[model samples]
Target chain A: MSGEPLLEVKNISTSFFSHLGEIQAVRGVSFYLNRGDVLGIVGESGSGKSVTALSIMGLIEKPGKIKQGEIIFNGEDLMKKSQREMCELRGNEISMIFQDPMTSLNPVYRIENQMVEVIRYHNRNLSRKKAVAQAVEMLRLVKIPEPEKQIKSYPHEFSGGMRQRVMIATALSSNPGLLIADEPTTALDVTIQAQILDLMNDLRARINASIILITHDLGVIAEVCSRIIVMYGGTIMEAGNERDIFYNPQNPYTVGLHQSIPSNLAISEKRLVPIRGTPPNLMYPPKGCPFSPRCSYTMRICLEEAAPTIRLSDTHISVCWLLHENAPKINGYSKGKIVDRYKTPSGS
Target chain B: MKAVDDVSFHIDRGETFGLVGESGCGKSTMGRTIIRLYNVTGGEIFLDGTNLTAMSEKNLLPFRKRMQMIFQDPYASLNPRMTVTDIVGEGILVHNIFKDRERQERIFELLDYVGLKREHANRYPHEFSGGQRQRIGIARALAVEPELIICDEPISALDVSIQAQIVNMLEDFQDEMKLTYLFIAHDLSMVKHISDRIGVMYLGMFAEVAESYELYAHPQHPYTRALLSAIPIPDPDLTRKNKRTILRGDVPSPIDPPDGCRFATRCPLVSDLCTKATPELIDKGAGHFVACHNV
Candidate 1:
């Protein structure tokens, strides 16, 4: 718990093997992601938050496996590497950005041969004319305005916010050290999902990198995470500090994912309180608190076991048993339009 | 409850109007210019009093078969190798209305009046579910029995648990088929719960029309007060005592659009006579309207 954790994941677990059998999509899911931390995982939608970012980009596939986890990163464990060393640490040292940028850009290639073959496969002393002039200067550092003739056009000639700024300029042209971003601006348009979350917060402060961000949009994890985790069914359920998971949310599934964020406030019955049922089926999931059957403070030891984490600070934690140390002190997570969610525009 | 800017508002004769906004408002070009499905250039639509911006799709196909449409990607508006009885009997065999096996028993009685399961009568829209491919695109515009249904953003591509089951089956097929709706959407609180006068579009026109509790109780244009202050409100203590109106920029391109009030380039009351004139819907007080030179 003392720094140096740039991306861990311990208990891991991620099953799929189907023919109606194994299904767990990331159960033991531990966390950690430092260096300019962005984190956010959130959930809903087979809530494994995109199978924990495709099990940290090893990009799990065959009836999706990673049956146990480790992932690690800097001290190297990315689950015992090799798919050619997890494809040269996937996009060279971690990078993802999915949620449909027109199904990952390649309508018969052209954004300069898909970002100069990702800077000639992560730099082989560049030069297909300097990797198409540095893929038009990384598509004008992803602000993408006429990046030299919009890199001779094609992923349907941009716009799904410039094909998610050319998939965030091919996930920041291989200058990666973590940047998963699954629902990367959920198929855009909220002012191009706030200009691709201000171009992934100016490419995470010009590539200091470290972001995980998966989403189900709690207003984009309260505007681009500083730390959130939540997840459901495939566990994790809470691990705070995006102001204790959006304002002291002590997990009731991060207070129903901050009461399912819709809030532009003062609502007079155009009502949607939603979050009632539909999530529990990692192929027959439910047992001990996978959000205790849509939890309204469920008890009787939340149907047989599981609720340990609790912790609260040294950067918050939670499994649930309503943070018990003789429980109680509950009530908090209910503020919205981000209750001035502690004035954060990066004041962290 | 009609006053947010209740002017020129008229959907009458079975009524659904619902326009709503956000996601680059224009309410799908005002429901494709009231189902001329785009042409209008400037104003005038008036259907039953017939202006339809001076008709002509062969006199607007007997007013486009009484104005029928219903899209919003029920898997890209059905046709995946068409089948659900020829995508709901291809608009009753293209408006010929009935022929083979009584157009397959009127596409199995418009798929059992939109509740489907006439054994999903030979299916395919990727084998249905996005509320049964929007009830086979509402039995393909109720197999052209149309009395005006535009719909356009129909359940904004489903899944809010099948968007309240395709908005309670488009309000029970508009209360047992009286049917009339423009209903474009971006979900301003489900167009104030299935509109009866809502409008508010922007960038392509109409900044307020009202009557869904008077445009969510008093909204008057500053782009319908930043689109009913951006409809989220699921509640976490009223988004902690509200204050959203965050409309700074973007939504300016309708090609050559901003000389004078195409929401004066993102209006937070922009005025130098709202960039010099083009502001006319005007009325104001009762059937409200507001094209805004400061309302």
Candidate 2:
């Protein structure tokens, strides 16, 4: 791995033009991925995590467009690429896996046909026999038993877990430099989810590819990611290394998300401090901070002015008015203090 | 090829017995079986000591009023065309609980109880958000004043921020109405928080059953331990350091499960005996039930 970043997304903004109005889905979200890094993007539905990934893949269609942003990959600007050029780069240099394996895979086609086609498509010089052989090896790499026989079966013949494994196998067959997995385990069960996560972690180590894992579950992010970015209303609320974000959270939204998750370590006796009110409507986004309505420590300034990204440390940054130096102190809004209040006495 | 085989548990008047499992583990099937939505193949279902399995449809009508269900996908469960008032009031009308203005007032109160405004009563399902739609679903379930509510993955469909709101609302309702819940979900942490007693299911049978704290603090079954360890705790340091028991393969098909323990195919400590005979849900101690040959 070199010192250069694998992917750099700078001030990307995306919007969907519907009949009713324009939805500001991704509002100036930015992040960078390093080589061999597993970066997790944690956000709820309509949080622009999916949209941002789509923007990177150049999958956004009519009515949806990337308004502004510079997506530089391997020192080249992706936005400047032609559709044909982007298409060439999509599966060859960058691979992606979606949430539902059923829809992502073709039900009528055999797994061998799908996996081999992807491998052969990327390596055009390879012979069909070699492609098939590579496909079988990839299947085995994902730990699918009886890969030779299973490869001939249709997607429906495989179980949910097996199908996802097949999807991972197909994605990795291309040997892309960057792998974007969007809620890869959300549709599977917890035990099966663990299996997939373990496989992903193992594959990441062996393949030497940077992974951008997008999910709403903080636990999943904590488990696999080296770095994380918390997004809300399509904006990056906080970005930091895993320990800095988890142990020393500075954003109120991030803190709320951490407290909301019911810890398996202990049965919580008290009610979870739920972030009141629903997510802000993306179509009619708030004038100032999008999270102001639900924020507990919302001051008049929060409702009037957009929050600036405050650098808490060299490795941590949060976009919140509470981080302002002249901001009035709240009981639990102090830097690193909010996370301590919710820490289990026994510790994790 | 039974989806749920010989699963039995009792819920007291005001207790919440949570059923937790991975997808396709028959937790939802168990919930449906209990509510009589799916016919029981070969087991007795007793409600307040009455054999609900023996009752015919005509006789089961009255019991249906006392047993309600909140589905997982609020988007699909509610009729998009129907107004919230009609949707919530439909149950009351069928049960003949109230009439005319009284029914309308009851619907408004149910809406208010679930944290929705009176103005929302006239809106359609499509008009409301996911959490709001779930609230409407809850209002519909509570319309008939049911005693036992089957919450089948109620919070899974909503956003993280909104999940807590629904959970808090459910807890408040449980406290006020003394409603017994058979909550079925895959998320173990949330189940631990809300359930008085929790049952871990695998394939189509109960792997372990214990009081909430006991189950989380000291899970006995290998499947339970693996399931618990697999759950990513929010703390990065703790989760990264925790040793995970990653199962070998995917869950076997339920069509023709192994003759022995359903989990024997993937169990880490599988032995010849495990593949030869089935394990019964036996009481270990202090009401903790485990169904594993090794245990």
Candidate 3:
């Protein structure tokens, strides 16, 4: 909508060189992140949502290589940058918060040590004492009860919700421009999931940081994302604003995802139309659309050919043969309160 | 569907009754309590018109054979070293229902009854997938030929696609054996599909109990209302507009619940009366039972 975008990930293709030949993890994936923007990478369990994020951060491990594409951040392409250069930018310019904080956080180290180190790494000029104080303040911002006391407590001592708060606090310590959250609340209770989402939204406002969230649930994308990218089987099936993706889905995969949700099962269509088949084996993906086997609207072309990207405005786009030239008519049967919700907005 | 709570419902011989709720609620505890699994924790426990709570273990033995439990976790429930044949036929061996070749034959029948191949009877629990292991567990429970089976979150750990299969199998068995079930699980929508009646548990107590359709369609309890509202639907527009009744804090610890109404802490419509007195689960109309200060 404006001059230069903050981050433009151009045609990024990542692959893992396994014994089964080069297994492509991210197939020519391309998207951009803007300042104060919350971009949601939505997909099912094995949709390469996490891998796409890792590629941007240059955190992909050995054997997995970014063969093509440039992650252009502030004019400097992170893809072309040296590993040393990327390391300097990490935690300082771009911070990441992963799911399952217990595994990421060291069992031996105190919470204070990790947080203070992050602050010192980014803003070296600040004193250790001042940084530790800021860490406590950041902990309080995430709404953790007794932050002063909890800071001294180990990751094991805190509950699932509290540990996530600590993780978020640590992510913010560096004052990064972009915050990458990967299924941060999937393990927590629904109530706690809501609170964590609220915290992330509030923190975005406080720090003026852009967010890139990866989650399995589309509803989560609606609640937090300004822009949504629906991925399936290592490729972007659809991209749009929160309104367009949910209200007027173009991709058959996207429509299938909507119908797969359980809320509508009890209301109108008692039948739960789960994606008919399991996700294609990533080791050797199908020749055409990875979702073609499971897609309800599978045409002949959908099996042998890839659909060209259909742009529905500046904000919405989908990749599907159904939208191809004379992309024959299709109707979807999706119902219940949540589906019908976007007709009009409540006076907020 | 009939208002199961309203009908003064009692299962016939070999009937399966399903009781469902979310995490941290007391549905699992209710299963154990009814079966005297926790030694009769405050309830009038009756099985086959016999008072089970008052009966001693020696006397309860005969009645115990009338009931059995299938746990949720397949990985943890079955002893790793035990073969499927041993696991299934153990009940028959214990009760002296069959001996040697007869027990083996009974185990094979159970395996066939639960949709497992008779050939899988000798395999270890570690060798099976989540769904197959659950099938084996069901076969073991059926081997005893119990009238009532307490399925405690049976399919919760399995995949969604696998969930419907297990539920259908259970339904078929219930039809065939006239099995009585206390199906406990956290899947509310699935519960509505499978259960004749639904009981919404909150903070170790039943918030609402009514027929499946009636309870989900028009929930009486505040906690139920809030819980239903908070679930995000796949529909984007409705999800955005639907006023989510986000419960302020998480469910309190069951060990030390609130003074009066257990759900009063998180209930959006909590009043002064809730703090002073616990609400009785009264029959409002059409068999709906709700426990709230004001509904």
Candidate 4:
């Protein structure tokens, strides 16, 4: 928390305009990433976690627009950059890895071609041979066995885990200061996912780069992320350090998410308390808090207007009407009390 | 190619047996084969001590009504053009269990049972969200009133919060109807939570099978150990110090698997004998079954 932030996102709002209506995917989202920090953005489908990452990379396509906000990376406002300028900055200083490795990778091209081209495209001065060597080294760094022979193989030849490794190798080939991984291991098997996560952790220590990990699995976030942001209905429901978010979640949505996941440490006999309903329709999002319909602690004020983000501590913030000073207290509904409801009476 | 080779397990009546494996590991194929959706290539499938694999399509008609399947993707599995009533009542109509007002009442009862309102019966599949569509799928599966249900990754496609809802509903239905379940999924924690016994599959064969608590507490197979170690615990403090037995390579192709063991290709405890002959599932005391030569 001492050094200057590597990336700062201020009040970014992204929306998609279709024939039906304007779908606000991300609204007034703000966060900062320090050097070497692994910040996790955890949310379910349509929670805008992936959209926020895409907005930072300037990859929002037709029908989608960054309606407002500024993205400052290393003291430069990325919104002011031209298309060509953004392209140069993409792989050079900022790289992203997607959920599906097959879609992100060029199927027809060999690993060598895809990786070497990326390396050389970012560093034009480097010779082709040097770039190829760098690509091989990156593959080696990611612990892909037999990089020499594997480099000549096509994407189909590699397994899902290996292809993700290839994607990671390509993403880190240029030593980008910031890496955005959007559910990089979700498609992988658990054992393979562990290997990739270990590889990422090792690389983060060696490369000293910042990472924005986007995933729906809180377990994945808990494994590697230092800080966490809980998203729901295209809004930041809560944000704090990992310990705070997990142990002292203030928002009902965050509490519900935590309780819903069957914990390995807890007794399995206890039933999980599922959140009552589905996510809000973004095309016609509720006038107040989008999560009000599903929240257990939702009050009249929560349905009338959006709750302001209240600071629970120096490092924790949550948007909920229950955190309001004048809000009436509900039985068994407190800032950190919801977590205890899931505890097995017999104890762990 | 044999998608599921020599995989054998039995689900007791009114018991939930979970099958856990990665994609392409043949868990789904096994589920489909048991339900007789796929013709068995080299295995016998017995439901209620009757060999279903040997039955012809005409003869299989009666057994089909006894076992039903709920697919993984509700979005693709449900007919887009069909109304909720038509989808849920189709099974009842086919079996001639009811007609006219009786069928309508049964359909409404099913809708209410799955936690969906009676008004939703007239709506199309496209009108509902992913979770609601899954409820419709469940309602349809329940309409058959089968003794056994094959839930093949039923909650995987749903969001995390919605996943628990469907899981809880399944549990409730199981208690009420005494329906046996063959739950298949890759999510380890959820499988352990819902299942009485768990089977871990690698390639085309089971790596381990035991009671849920026994398998999780003391996994014998190297592949099983690696899989258990790989699951990321939700607690940050616990996960940081956990020693994971990270497997090195990808799962071998099931088309022409290795001679000895399917997992021997990437297993850390592989030996010369492992690559030479396939290991059979051995009984390791207290009903724990393991398929590893080293163990």
The C-alpha TM-scores of every prediction are 0.34, 0.96, 0.79, 0.96
Instruction: Say which prediction, candidate 3 or candidate 4, comes out ahead on TM-score.
Output: 4
Residue A232 error, candidate 1, Å: 22
Clashing pairs in 2: none
Q: Candidate 4: where are CA atoms >4 Å away? A: A330-348
Q: Write the per-residue lDDT of candidate 1 for residues B18-113, one digit (tens) a residue.
A: 886556555665666677666665558788997878776786776787878888888887878878998788766766878999899888888888
Cα misplacement distance, residue B239 of candidate 2 (Å): 1.0
Candidate 2 stretches greater than 4 Å from native: A331-348
lDDT of 1 by residue, A1-348 (tens): 355677777777789988978888778777777777887777767778898788888878898888775777888887876788888778877888888899888799788988888778878887799888877888888767668887888887566778887887777787787878788776665545656676676777877788888876566666657777777888886766766766677777666555443334334344344455456767778777788887878777876676666564567766777666555555663222211111111111
Question: Superposing all C-alpha atoms, what RMSD in Å does each candidate have to the true structure?
Answer: 23.2, 4.2, 6.9, 4.5
Report chain B TM per candidate.
0.39, 0.99, 0.91, 0.98
Model 3: per-residue Cα lDDT over A146-243, one tens digit each = 78888888888776778889888888777788889999877776667767877877887787789999988776787788888888878888787877
Candidate 1 positional error at B207, Å: 5.5
| Candidate 4, lDDT over the whole model | 0.89
Instruction: State, as a TM-score between 0 and 1, how close model 4 is to the true structure.
Output: 0.96
Give the winner by TM-score: 2 or 3.
2
| TM-score for candidate 4 (chain B) | 0.98
Query: For each prediction, how big is the interface RMSD?
Result: 12.8, 1.0, 3.2, 0.7
